[model samples]
Target: MADIIIIGGGIIGLSSAYYLSKQGHQITVIDKGDLTDNCSFGNAGMIVPSHFVPLAAPGMIRQGIRWMFDSKSPFYVKPSLGGGLPAWGLTFLKKSTQRHVEESALPLRDLSLLSKQLFQDLAKEPDFDFELRNNGILAFYKTEKAAEEEAHLAKRAIELGLDMAVLSKAECEALQPKLKLDVLGAVHYRCDAHLYPVKLMQALIKYLEQKGVKIVRNQEVTRMTTNGSQISSVFTGTKEWKADQYILATGSWSPAVAKLLGLNISLMPGKGYSFMEDEPQQRMSIPALLCEARVAITPMNGQIRYGGTMEIAKINSQVNMNRVEGIVASVPKYFPDLTPAVPALKDIWYGFRPSSPDGLPYIGRSPKLNNLVVATGHGMMGLSLGPATGLLVSQLVSGQRPEIDIQAFLPQR
Candidate 1:
């Protein structure tokens, strides 16, 4: 069995370690943070097969441009004179075509379905308990135009074989009795599932430790030394570590690491914010998306999680109060009876989504580095697609045929 060193202790890295360890491979995971908080911890926690439409879809460029100036908008891209952000933005604009969206749908749907199944399998394992729920997801819209738009997507989803149903406002109210919505209609994707992200991460980490996976936290990967096409060793300040294979799952910071091997991976950090309510007045049995607001609400474990907002900025951990307020403002719009309480800003969690230009993750070996496999650039779908990404990564590492077509996700293709 090959000894593997996995970078970043996020869901992707952890999941990869889990599968690799099961294959009897010795695994080591490294991360810069405490591994308790990150994007993987604060996501909407929805295993969304309905989200087949990638972020780089048609009309997003126009929407992005319109929302660029609004700090409280659902999406915002900070204007930067620096070449890195601009270059990525241009490529993102270029990829926001109908063809890219059409091509991305199948792979995303397959991976999401695969991940949902894998999560189900993991849930049945004795040591793995993370409040997995398959109650489906509701995407509610306030205006008829919005509902019509979603209905169009729902029809397309049906064409792709996803279990989707469009519902009127009354029908939505029937399903979610507690939510006092001002919605015109809703689209329910029965194929989606939800979980408590933090709980899931904690359980995974514990299970990995029990299975003898070495987790080194607070140690950042500084440099990589290579011999021809293979990585010889990785440096992290005080130590030089060698492994038969390496997996890069560093999320937003992946591009910097890739640069060490002379690979140009355009990854922008899309910062998102979330805050959990203490005993929310209203509860949702199924997770729901406020379509116009672009906010996601999920009833996780015992608390209510409200999360949304995409700010394309440099990788900084600073929490913007305006963005947090934007998410808070959206709560009342969806659930009309819910009062806006002062969210604990200090307790609010924020993490950067590792967004790629084409909205598809890079999940294969870099052509420049033979032993190194790239698995970041998942953006918002990282948690939803983690298990499938891990399974595919393991297949690549093990010299087995991949279960899904990875042409769109191939690095340097």
Candidate 2:
């Protein structure tokens, strides 16, 4: 079996390690931070097959411009002048076409379904409890205009063979009888699911450790030494780690890491935050996405997690209070009976998503380095696509064919 090294200990890297180890390969995972800390730990935790359309869809450019001035907007691109943002912007604008969304839908759906199945399979394994729930997710709209637009998207999803229900406000409230909903209508995607992200991450780390996966934490990969077209070893200042194969799963930092290998990958960091509190006074059985507010609310493992905002900017840990406030403010508007006590600013968690220009992940082998495989850029769907990507990585490393077509997600794309 191959000696594989996975960079980035988030969902993608951990899942890759888990699957590769099951194939009897010796796996080593390296992360810049401790394994306990990552983007996967604090997210909406939704396994969303409903999200077939990529983020760079038609009319997004217009919405982005309108949100530019609103600090509390769900999507905000912090004004910046340099560091490849201009190039990424141009590519994003170019890819924001109807054709791109249509082409992306099938692959996204396939990958999400595969990952969801894998998640279900794992839920049955001993000592693998992570609060996996298949109750589905509700995407509710407060205005008729937004609800009508969602109906159009729901139609597209239905055409793709997804199981969904366009429910009236009364229907939504009936589904969650214990809570009151303040929305015009909702679209329930039965294909979607939810989980507790922190529990999953913790369980995976423990299981991998038990399975003898080497996890080196707090060691940042500074550079690599190349021998011809292959990467001989990756260095983290004091030490060098060598493996038969290397995988780049370092989400937002992918572009910077690839720069060392002379590959200009158009990737930027889109930061998102999630704050959890004890189950609210009014509990909802299903997770819901407030369409107008751009916030996601989930009842996870007896706790309520409210997350939103996509701040496309350079990677940093600075917390935006306004953005956090926006998420909390929307909670009351959607669940009228609920009064969510906002978590302390210090308690909030934020992580940068590795957003690609075209909104599809950059997966597959590197053109420059023969032994290196690129597997980052899942963006908001990293949690939703993690296991399927891991399975694909194992296939590639084993010199076998992937179960699904991944042409659109190749690094060369």
Candidate 3:
């Protein structure tokens, strides 16, 4: 059995550990933080197979340019003096083409579908319970123009074999009678599932511990010692742990770790904010996305969670109130009857999603080093794609054929 060490204890790292341990590999996971709060815990808890379109799609450049100056815009890229930033931005613009979108749709859809199945199987595990709900997701649009755009996308999704239904305003209201929405129409994707992220993380950690996986929390991997092409040991302050293999699953901070090995990976931190209300009046039976606002609302374990905003800033954990207020403003727009009390500044939680230039994550082995696999760059889909990625990582490590074609996710291709 190979002694493997995984860096980063986020959902991706922990999930990889879970799968690798099950395959009889001795595993140790290290993280800088306590692993209690991060992107995996603060995400919009969506198992979305319908989100096949990558972020760097056609027409996004114009939209991003229009929203560039707006502080509370759904997507904002903070202009900076960094050298790599311009190169990444240019590459992102170049990939924002119809051909690229068409090319990416199939791989993203396949991975998401595989991930959905894995999540369903995980729900059936004896001691695993994280509020898995298959009530589906509704993407609501307020204007006729927005509805038309969504309808076009829905048709493409349907062509890709997704269970999608376009609903009129009245039909959408019938599904959720409480939400008096002011929307022209809605697109319902029945193939989606929702969960409570915090609950899921806690349950998975507990399950892994019970199964005898060594979880080393609060330990940061400072450096890596390599002998020729193989990594010899991982250094964490005073401790040196030797491993036969290493998996890099660090989220937004992955680039820094990759730099230690002289690997050039273009990953930016897209920060997002979210908050939970103690007693929210707007109780949703199904999760919904405010299409224009780009906000996601999930009914999780008796409380409502409002999550949105994509600020393309550097990896700083500062909570911008203006951005948080944007998410709060969107709540009443969708659920008019619900008036959420303004949360205190301290109550709002923010986490960085590791975004790639072309919206596709880097998931395969690094060509520079043998026995070192990279699994970061899931961006906003980290929670949605965690289990499937873990399974794929295990397959690669064990010298078995992967379930999906990993050419798109290759570290160097």
Candidate 4:
């Protein structure tokens, strides 16, 4: 059996460890933090098979430029010439064509469908009881423009063999009878699902530890020693750890870790914010995505978690209150009564999504290092796509064929 070392303790790393250990491989997971703080948590907890479209799609540049002027806009890219942003921006512009979107649809759909099935399977496991709900998500639109956009997307989804239906305001209200909606119309993506991310991550860590996987928390990889093309050892301060194979699943910090191994990947940290509030009434059973505002509100863990905004900037600790306010302001527009107050700074949680320029994740073997697997750049869908990525990583490590064609997710592409 190969001894494998996985860097990063988020959903991807832990999921990889879970599958790799199931194959009877000796596994070790090392994380820079105590595992509680990562992008895997503080997310919208959406398992979206409906999201086949990548971020780098047509008309995004026009919309992004419009949003740039508004402080409370859902998407923002901080101006910077340093640290790969310029080149990433150029590639993003190049890939934002209709041809790119058309080409990316099938692979993304397949990956999402695979991950949704895997999530269903994982929920059935004895050790897991994370609130895995398959109630689907509602994409609510308030404007005619947004309604047209969603209708077009729903049509594409239906053509690709996905279950989606366009709903009127009355139909949307019937589905969500407990709350009032001011939307013009909505699209019910029957293919999507949701879960509590904290519970999922906790269950994975607990199960892996019980199965004898070494989890070294609060240990950051400071340096690496490589022998030719293979990684000889990894160092965290004075201690050294070695394994037969290595997996780099670090989320937003992947580029920095790859740099240590003389590899460069085009990735930017798209920071997002989330805050939870008590919803004892459980008024919203189905998760709702505000079409124009780009906010996501989901009923999870006896509370409603409101999350949104994509700030493409350097990773930092300061919380942008304007972004959080943007999420809060959008909620009342859709659900007139569901007004959530601006959460205090301490309660607000922000995490960076490792976004690729082409709006697709990088999940494949490194061409430069035979023993290494690169699995990051999942962007906002990291949690939704975690299990599929982990399963593919296991298959890649075992020299078996991947379940899906990973040509679109090549790291060097």
Candidate 5:
């Protein structure tokens, strides 16, 4: 069995450990913080095969620039003259083309569908049960402008062989007769699914432990000691850990870790926030995206979670109350029956999504190192893409071909 050390204990790291351990590899996971809190918690727990388009597609530059001024807008970018963001900006602009989006769609669709199936299989395992639902996701739009855009995207999705339906206002109301929606129309992706993220994380971690994977929390990798073509060992916060193969699954901090080994990856942290209501005044039967506001609403574990706002900024958790309020403000406009009470800054949960310049994940072995693999930069789709990434890492380690073509997700690209 190979000795593998996985850096970062987020969903990607833990999932990698699970798959590797299952294949009889002696696994060790190192994390910078205690495993109690992580990027996996408090996220909109949806498995979306419907999201085939990359975030850096055409017209995003205009929208991101437009939203740059509006604090309440769904997307924003904090200007930074340093930290290689300018270079990333240029690359992002170049990748925001029809060619990029078309090239990205099929691979992304394959990955999400595979991960969704893996999640289903994971649910059937003993003690791994959580709130797994096939209730699907509704992308509801209130504005005619947004509705037209969604309709175009839905047409593209249908052409791409995705299972979806374009529902009029009355059809939408028919599906959700309980709650009143203030939307012109909705695009229903029937292949999507949702689950309780916290439960999934807990179950996966527990299963890994039971299967002899060593998980060491609060141990951060500070540096790497490498040979000519392979990483010999990694220096962490308290000690140096060596392994035959290493997987760098650190979420938002992937680029920083890659730089330690002289690897170039264009990654930025996109901060997002969410507030949970103990008992939703208006509980949604299915998860829905307020398309105009980019706010995500999910019914999970006796509570409803409203999450939105992609703030591309530096690495910190200083809560922007305006952004949180913006999410709360958009809810009532979309779902009239649900007037949510805003929570204090302390009560809200926020985390950084590892965003790539082209909105595609980095998943493969580092070109410079023989035994190092990079499995990060998933952005908003990290939760949806975790298991497939793990399975791919395991396949790479075992010298077996991956099920999906991974050329699009090569770390160097």
Candidate 6:
């Protein structure tokens, strides 16, 4: 078996290590932070096959422009020309076409389904128990415009062989009998599932350690040495680690990491925020996605995690209270009894999602470096797509055929 070194300790990196070690490969996962929290932990924790629509879909540019004016908007791009934002924006504009959306649906659906199945399989293992629930998610809409859009999307999902149904407000109430819904209608995405992300991350770390995988924390990759067209070794200040193969699974930091090797990858860090609250009553059974608000509410670890907003900009440590307020404000408008207060700054959690211009993830082998594989650029779907990407990464490293055709997720695309 080959010795593999994976950079980034988030869900994608750890998942890659998990699968690689399972195949008898010597794996070492290195991260800049302790393996405690990340985008993988503080997310909505929904495994959604229902989310086939890419972020760069039609009408997004028009909507994004309007949202730019509001500090509390669900989507905001901090005005800046630096950090390659202008080029990424232009490519995003170019890809926000109906043809792109139509072309992306099948591949996104197939990838999500594969990941969902893999999660189910993992949950059955004795060492893994992350509260994997297959009850599906509810997309609640409060306005007529949102209702019509959701209906159209549901119809398209059904056409793609995904299980979805349009439900009236009464039908929605039937699903969550304990809580009162103040919405016009909802789309029941029965193909989706939910899990506790923190537990999931912890379980993977524990299981990998038991199986003899080395997880190195607080080690940031500084440089890489190349022999011909292949990567020979990676440096993280104190250590020079050599491996037969290297995988770049860093999330939002991928662009900077790729730049170390003189490669240009068009990606931006889309920062998002989330906070959890005690839900002793457990009023919410199925996870809810507010259609117009773009907020996600899910019950995880006996608490409710309210998360939303996609702030595309450079990575920083500032907490935008307005965005968190927007998430809190939208919850009551949908579920009247489920009003969450704006969390304190200390209670808030934020993570940067590595987003690509075309909205699909960057997977598969790098064209310039034969020994390097790229697996970042998952955006909001990073947690949802983790296992499938990891499995595919292992397959690529082993010189075996991937389970699905990954042409749509090529890194150099």
TM-score of each: 0.98, 0.98, 0.98, 0.99, 0.98, 0.99
Top candidate on lDDT is 4
Higher-ranked by TM-score: 2 or 6: 6
The weakest ten consecutive residues by lDDT in model 1 span 275-284
Candidate 3 wrong stretches, greater than 4 Å = 279-282
RMSD list, candidates in order: 1.2, 1.1, 1.2, 0.7, 1.1, 0.7
Candidate 5 regions off by >4 Å? Answer: 280-282
Per-residue lDDT tens digits for candidate 4, residues 141-195, read: 9899999999999999999999999999999888878899888989999999999
lDDT of each prediction vs. the true structure?
0.89, 0.90, 0.88, 0.94, 0.90, 0.93
Backbone collision count in every prediction?
0, 0, 0, 0, 0, 0
Residues 285-331 of candidate 1 have per-residue lDDT tens digits of 88989998899988886778888999888988687888778878888
TM-score of 1: 0.98
Candidate 6 lDDT for residue 384: 95
Position 353, candidate 3: lDDT: 94
lDDT tens digits, residues 1-413, model 3? 89999999999998898889899998888899888997999889999998888899988889998988777888999888682678779889989888988999999999999999999999999877899999999999988888898999899999999999999989999998877887788999888989999988998899888877888988888888888898888888989999899999999999888888878888888998888875455457889899999999888868887889998878775777877778788778877875566579888888999998999988998897898999999989999999989999999999989999989989784
By lDDT: ranked, best first: 4, 6, 2, 5, 1, 3
CA lDDT, candidate 4, residue 68 = 99
Per-residue lDDT tens digits of candidate 6, residues 53-101? 9999999988999999988999998879899899999999999999999
Model 2 residue 102 lDDT score: 92
The true-structure Cα RMSD of candidate 2 reads 1.1
Among all windows of ten consecutive residues in candidate 6, which has the lowest summed lDDT? 330-339
- Candidate 5 CA-lDDT value: 0.90
